[model samples]
Structures are given as structure tokens and as C-alpha cells.
Target chain A: MSAATPPSAVGPPAPGDAGVLVIDCVLVTEILTGFVREEVGKVGFRRGVVGLSGGVDSALTLAIACRALGAENVVPIVMPYRTSSPASERDARRVAAQLGADPLVIDISAQVDAYFERLPDADRARRGNKMARERMSILYDVSSARHALVIGTSNKTELLLGYSTIHGDSAYALNPIGDLYKTQVYALAGHLGLPEEVLAKAPSADLWEGQSDEEELGFSYALVDRLLFHMVDERRGRDELLRLGFDGGFVDQVARRVRDSQFKRRPPLIAKLSQRTIDRDFRYPRDWGR
Target chain B: MLSDPDVLAELAGEARPDPVVALAQGAPRLGDVPANVDRHLELIAQAAERGADLVVFPELSLTGYFLKDLVADSAVRLEGKEISALARASRAVDCVVGCILEGDDHRLHNAAVYLSRGEVVHVHRKVYLPTYGLFDEARYLAAGDRFRAFTMPLPSARAHREWRAGILICEDLWHPTSPAVLARDGVDVVICPSASPGRGVGSGAELGTAQSYDVMTRTYAQLLTTYVVYCNRVGYEDGVGFWGGSRVVGPDGEIRGEPASREEAMPLHRLERGALRRARIANPMLRDERHDVVDAEMRRLRRRSRM
Candidate 1:
């Protein structure tokens, strides 16, 4: 490399001398679906299944999979809990209708209640996690029974914050929206021209009645994302942030959420006393040993 | 990939075209940051005034990198009221420093503000994050997944001279996908803002730090057939010493200009635009791309047991 002068010396071209490099995200996504299609063919599999909850993320996932693998290749599972809203069920069926995928309406309320009856000492978080795990178990079982891989529905935002239930919603053979933010998801949904009902509804896990994502987090995705942007993207300091015109209370809150969620972002910690740990000591890609 | 000989012959044959580059280097830290960002900006502005077309800064140029707690406080909403000062500055000097952009996505990103023709043209976020080592990027950032490209005024203010440029945050340049994507999309030059750590690398060590990085740069510049202006940060931050050895490697595996290692000096390089067109004509890697090779996900799935 030349060492005499840095490249920052060059001046920008005058007005009208620059060419724009716009990314057609929609087209890229279509290309992604094409890749998924080719992947399914390469695997010699014609069928796939999706656990659709009528949420925008899942609906979009199911829709994309349907386009890539076809309606016959995709399955939509709506496993409603006791508190699952009717709107959620309707949304799931609506998405299935739009995508032409058959809907499997399996109300797991009774089964979840049975488990709770056996173990009355379970806490809310535990119960919620159990519900999530139960959904995954059903999806995987159907996957095995149908000889198909379960397509993951979690988006990038959930992945970053560890907002997903591990071994439950997070376990998947493949994921499409793993790189997009919640905000970007909305944009993509618009590009896909999805049903307005799914796009307009407030985001929710539908684990419990009226449980919204923003309410539980005690902050909006907008504010949390901004705070995260400052901390994560810009690599700014906490004190300098206050000088930049953000509320101290909000900054501290977002920082705490990001800090507390670190455990979720990593592989489960194994005591280093043992020689071999999963990600750290025994490092390999997912396909290793196979 | 085209051989170096093939690239050099083509570049040598092309008419000597004036070089224009848009730079993106390390920016100032928010609070308690070393006084290099402002000083560097001043140096870059002066260099630009001396007929340099574009002067780029690193991600978060006005602030330090990885200010985890300081983002909310130091974040600048590019479209909001905070960018007024930057807009004014860009208009005054006709240069854009890659600014720490507080995006309306409600996310703070290590973004580059392309100030050209007296306006902020576009902003690019750092796509790849270095989560390992002393970096805890995943803790604070939402990774950028899109490969949106931007066109800026060629660093030469010459009328009728247009150039396509792309901005990649530090870690993004390390990955082949970034340059590949940009080059395939038809960018003339790729600017990288690197905050690489400086250290005493043992001579002849297994990982031989000195020779390794320049090799990486040469390989990429030649492979992509695009001008590469790598502006690395100098000095240290939080025990990490930045080795400032910024350089511009031509598309044909030769150095046009190299800055002193870890020096707080702003040296300028003159690049010939004709060199790029000539290099591309000789070895058109962009025209010969097979996107099938870019998939890490599908490969992982296939390698796993089908059972």
C-alpha cells in the first residue's frame, strides 16, 4: 500500500457528478426466496412447515416460505394458548388463506393447563417459557412426522436482544428475517404488500392476553433502538450521551436492558473448570461432526 | 480472481486519469476522547482545500467507537435538529466527515455522512460488527443487514466527472462479502474506516502482523478491481492502540500512497480515475460474479446431517 498520503485528501465530486447506489431490498428478498427454493430442491425436500401466530414476523416468514417452497411444501401451525386472542387466530388463518397454506389449528390450552396442574409451583416466566418450548416441541414433532425442516420466524431485533425463547422459537433449521430490524420488517411487509391488519396491529408474542412487546419492555422499540444505536453502533460513552441531549433516565434504562440481556445473546455459560465447553472450548460450525 | 500481472498491464495501458477518493476514517470519541478527531478533521479539510476531492472520516468521527453508554447522549439525529451544524460545516468546506448518525430507525449507528456539493448526500451504517475481543458491539447495536450503495460527487469538483463510491464500516471491509457486493454493484472505489488496534507484534511470528494486513489490502484491491482507500485510526482507546497506517492501493496490486504507521499526520494521495476503468477492462471481476458462492447459511444446513 502507498504510504505517502492518506486517501482522505481527495475532494468530493461537484453536484450532479455522483451516481446513486440504491438497494432494492424487496428484489433481494425475492432472490433470497429463490435461494431457499433451490436449497429445498438441493435437499430433495418438497415440504416445509411454519408455526404462524398471525404476527407480522411469522406471517411474513410463512408467506416467503410459501413462495419459495410452494403452498403444498409449507404448513402453518396456529397453536393457541388459553389466553391467545381471537384476533391472533384470525390473523393466522388470514395469512394462511393469503399464502394458500393449510392452517393447523391446535389449541394447546388444555395441554398447557394439564402441565400447570401437575406443577402448580411454576412462575409466570417459567410458564411463558414452557409455552414457547411446547410450541417448538409440537413444531419439531410435526417436522419429524412430515419429514420437513421447521423454518424459523424470529427477526434480527429479537435475535440481538435475546428476546426469543431458546430451544423454542429460536430453534430452527433456517431463518430468513434474521437480518432485519423490527422497523425494517414493517418496510419489507409493505414491500410484500401484506394485509394491512397484520401490519397495523401492535407487535405481540400472544403468550398472554393483551401482552404487548413495548409494554413488557417498558419502552418503545423506537427509543430502545435509538439508545442501542448510540451504545452499540456509535460506541459512545454514557456521560457523553447526556451531553448530546438524551435523558439520563432513558439512557440508564436502555443500558440496563442491554446489559441484562447479554446472557441471552451468548451460548449458555459452562463452568470453565471443565476442560471442554460448548462454544468456547469446543468451537465448531453447526455442521461439524456431521 | 485475476492475476496481478493481468491487472497491472491493463492499468498501465489506460490513460492516466486523475484520482478522486471519498474517505471514511476513525472519528473522535464523545467524551474524554483524545484530541485527534478534531485535529484530523482539520487536517483532512486542509488537504481537501488543496484540491483533494473528498475527505472521509471513520465511523463516529466526531466521537470514539464503542461508546456503549454514551450513544443516547452523544447520538446525533442526522435528519433532526442536531445535523444543522454538520450541514453548515459541509456546505462551508464542501467535504463530509463520516458522522455518527442517530438514525430515525430509532437506532444509533456508526454511520458516514457523505457531505458533497454543500449537502449531506447519504448515510451508510456499519454492517459488520466485531463482537469478539475487547469489542462488545452486539451488546449495543443492531447489525445492518442491507447492502445499500451510495453515489457521491467524485472527490474531484470537476464538472462532468462522476464517480460511484461505497462506504463500509471497519469490520465490513474485512469480510469479502462487502467489497464483493459493492464492486458487483458497480462502485468505482470503496472507502473503509478502520479503528485497528496497534501493538508490538513479534517479528517473524506465526501470524506476522506487519505483512498480513497489507497482503489482505492488496488482494482485495486487485480482486475487486476497485480503488481502495483504507484510512485507519491512530492512537489508543481503552487500552487498544490504533495503528494508523492509512493507505490507498490501486486496483492493480500497487500502492499509490502510504501514510506513516501510527502517525498523527494527514498525508494526501492523488489517484487516477483512468486507472480504475483500465483495470476493470483488463480484469472484469465484477462482470464475472457468481452469487452462488456467497451463501454460508445453505452450506451450513447441507453439511448438517439430513436425519
Candidate 2:
């Protein structure tokens, strides 16, 4: 390799240019598949239970899990709320059939509605949170019953922006695509030959009838993924972000979201009283023995 | 198996041919030293069956890389039973094994032990403890202070050639001065054992970590005019996966065999003395190295920094 001019000498890419966000799909696929296989196998589980929402993130995650732990070894569970789009369920089933893995459909409307009957005035956010947690509880229950680990499907954009419920869809035994951005998730999904409907549809939480992620966030995933890549991954500061042609308000807004949602990314903090605290100074790897 | 007496007689009789080195790229169970020792013994025996004269394992092969607080729990003293077991296994073939070494001063270190002829031939603790970005080695372990080269006996048909060998554990090779010191010490081969995690998967078939290692090892081999044997581990430890791309780079900076990635593999390659001699003769970079100038400049810079 020849010594080239430093990147600092060459200015950063203009905003909306997401060329740096593009990944080598083949190599990323190998790494994620190997990660799933080793992490799941190390914990002594031969099967994985994924909460497939028919969104690109979950669909891509399930596909990778099936590739890692064979389609026969994966149990893709689709738990749809009553307000969720019917297209989601159809797309999820299509993906499962395409991967040759039989998926179990569990309608969560009964439990969600039964609990909400007492509080008729509950808002959309409350209902969405309840539905997400309800799905999480069901997935864990099935994970126990089937003796499989629950694979997470939250993408990096959702995780960094704290766009996910804390103990809801954010919880899993292992996540293969949490580090990937939303754009990268769709890229990998395209490379894996997922259902065209799943890949082409707008991303959504589907908690209510017309819930769209981009509409709620008020910006495109393509734009934010590029902005976040420069801000977080490359460690560019506020001035440097503006120098890179990012809007001042947009950069501050995304930075604030990342900071505010930091609590959602970590475990509940424990107050220290002893000489060695659990997460402080008394740290051990999660995979200590196995 | 050859008896001790038979092996001695063979060694005394005639020099053997080129030495075959095996890279035992196996995943170690976390905090399980005894089980890892058993696995090391099995790999050693298998390499012996394949007629390998030397077998090199990845960094911390006896204990998983992300030991964290388990460093104390899995650390092995030099006179401990784990090293003794590995020493006994070395009676069959020479082996380089990595572990958490509990020093006589009670300070633990990330170390590699070279065992030969049922004895602990040399131990090189990792000099640089990388403590940033997914590495917390300095927080848990002590760093080694020096780099030294030792005699490694390789059998040749012409005569008994005592090859000078040095062991630079993982991050030590990242620093130019470490390998330069060994090159100045007249080391013929640098055995690097690594537990490198795979990252930066953008626009390449290889992980960024693997690509960086390839560049560094090949550059070191060509510049120093010495063989570079790299053995990196595979498997996951707490979600971080170590990429296994163990390889041998000749003095001419050419890769000899195919490297396995993200999986357990044992690749053995022959180290040709003729190739080493030819590269050194053609390059002659090591012959005219100005060490005195470097020493003078370093002293001057140290004084200037203090001022």
C-alpha cells in the first residue's frame, strides 16, 4: 500500500453522502453468522428464538440466525398486535417459508386488550410500550419452553437514538445486527435475498395503524445513518460535524438523543457501598466460563 | 513414539531437514486452564503426528483472552502443574503456549512460554498492554519490561544450526521498536501469538484487524529479513470474536500458505533456511543498521523531553 494524504487533509464527505456507511455485505455476513454460532453455542443452546416483526431489522436477524444455527434449529415467533398491519404478518411468514423455518404465530391482542380494558384513556405510547413488553415476555416464555436463546433485532440506528423500548424489543440473549445501521441492515437483507416486500417497506414499530419510523423521527434513515456514522463512530465533534456540512440543529438533536437515551442502553446502575462493586472494579466478562 | 534414548541418538547422529512449524489456532475455554492444557496436549500430539518440529498457539491459549477479573483465578505460576504438564508434552515436539503468568513477585502478566525437551526454555511476557477500545489488559495484568532473543535448535541436514528466536506477544509487534530490537539482537524468527478481535468490516473480504496484521507481519518480515509466524485464536469470548488467520510470512514478505479466518484451524508450513538466506543476502537491510545513531538520538530525545 502506498502512503496517501491524510483524511484530515481531504475534507470529510458532504452530508447526505452515505458512501462510508456501505459495508462489505459478504464479510459482514460471515462475521455475524460466526458471532451467532459461537455466542449461542458457547452458552449451550442449539436453538434460537427470534421475535420476527417482519421489519427489515428482525427479518435480517432471523435470516442470519437461521444461517448460523441452521433453519431447522431456529424458531421464528411472530407476535402481532391487533393494530399491527396485516402485511407485516404476511411478510414475516413469507420470510420464514423462504428460509425453510416454520414460524409460530401468536396474536397478542387478547392479553394487551385485557390489561388495557381497565385504562381506556391510555395513550398510543403507553399502548405501544405495553405491546412491546408483552411481546418480549412472550418471547422469553417461548425461549424457556423451546430451550432456545432469544435473538435481538434492534439495529444500531434504533439503539443509538434510543428509539426502542427499554425492556421490550431491546432485550435478547444475543444480537447479531445491533451494531449495523438501518441502511446497513437493509443492505445486508438485500444481499441475503430476503422477501422484496420486507426489504422495500418503510420501517415501522407497527404499534398502531399508521406508525412509520421515519415519519415519527422526521428525517430519513439514510441521512441520520450517515450523520451518526461521522458523529459517533468517527468521533467528530459539533464544529467538525458542521464543517462536514451537517446542519447545526440536526447535529445537536441527534447528539442529544444519543446522550439522553444512554440510560436505555445499559443495565440499571447499582449504588456502591462495598470495596468492590459489581460493575465497577469487580468486572468480569459475560462469558466467563463457557 | 520414539524413546528418549532413540531421540537422543538421532539428535547426536545426523542433522534433520527443514523444520515444520504448526499454528494451533484453537479456542480456549474461559478461565479453564486445566481443560485448555488438555486441549493443548491434544493439539501438540496431533502436530507431532503430522511431523511438526515446532507448534505455536495463540495468545492466552491456556485461558481465554477476555479474562477480566478471572486473570487471578486462571493465572499459572512458572513452577505450577499447568506449565509442568505442557513441559512434559514438549518432550514430543517443541511448543509455544500462551497463558496468564503469575510471577514470583506475585504480579500477573500476559505471557508466552516456549517449551522444548521437557523444559521451560524461555518466557516472554507481553510488553505492551493495550487498554483502549475493547482491550482492558493493562487494568488486569502487568507489562513485561524487556525483549530478549534465545537459541532455538533447528535440525538441518548440513549441520546443527542454532537459530536465534524471539517471542513478541500480539501488541508488541505493533510497535516498530520491539521488532527492531529483536532484529538487532540477530533473531531469525519472530513468533507472534495474538488474540485479536475482528472489527471494521467495510469494503473488504478481510476484517480490518486481519488486514492490519497482514501488513504489519509482512512488513516486519521483509524489513527485518526474518521469518514471521503469526498464530491468532478463533471463537468468541463475551461477544467479541477472535479472527483466526494464522500464517507464516517468509523473509521475502510472501505468505507461504492459506490462512483460515473466523474458525479453528491448524496450518503447518515448512521454514526454508535457503529462503531466509536468500532474502537476507538480497536485502542486506539488517547488516548496515545504525543502532548507535538510534541510541544517541533516543537519549537526546529523552533528555529534551525531560527539559
**Native contact fraction per model:** 0.00, 0.91
Model 2, span B1-307: residue lDDT tens: 3454434445476433668899999899999888999999999999989988899999999998999899999999889999999998888888999999998799999999999888889999999999998888998999999999997654321224566889999999999999999999999899999999989988877889999999999999999999999999999888788888999999999889787666788988988766776798899999878888989999999999999
DockQ of each: 0.01, 0.79
**What is the lDDT of every predicted structure here?**
0.66, 0.89
Lowest summed lDDT window (length 10), candidate 1 chain B: B199-208
Docking class of 2: medium
Question: What is the CAPRI rating of model 1's predicted complex?
Answer: incorrect
**Model 2 per-residue lDDT tens digits across residues A1-290:** 11232223224446445478889999888888988998999889999999988889989999999999999999999999888999999999999999999999999999999999999999999999999999999999999999999999999999999999899999999999999999999999999999999998998999999899999997788878888999989998887777667677888888999999999999899998999999888988899887
Question: Tens-digit lDDT track for model 1 on B124-160?
Answer: 7778878986676666666776655677655355523
Per-prediction backbone clash count: 49, 0
**Which segments of model 2 are wrong by more than 4 Å?**
A1-18, B1-16, B154-159
- The prediction achieving the highest TM-score against the true structure is 2
Candidate 1 per-residue C-alpha lDDT over A208-250 given as tens digits, one digit per residue, 9 for 90 to 100: 8888998887666654554455566558797655544456777
Check candidate 2 and list the clashing pairs: none
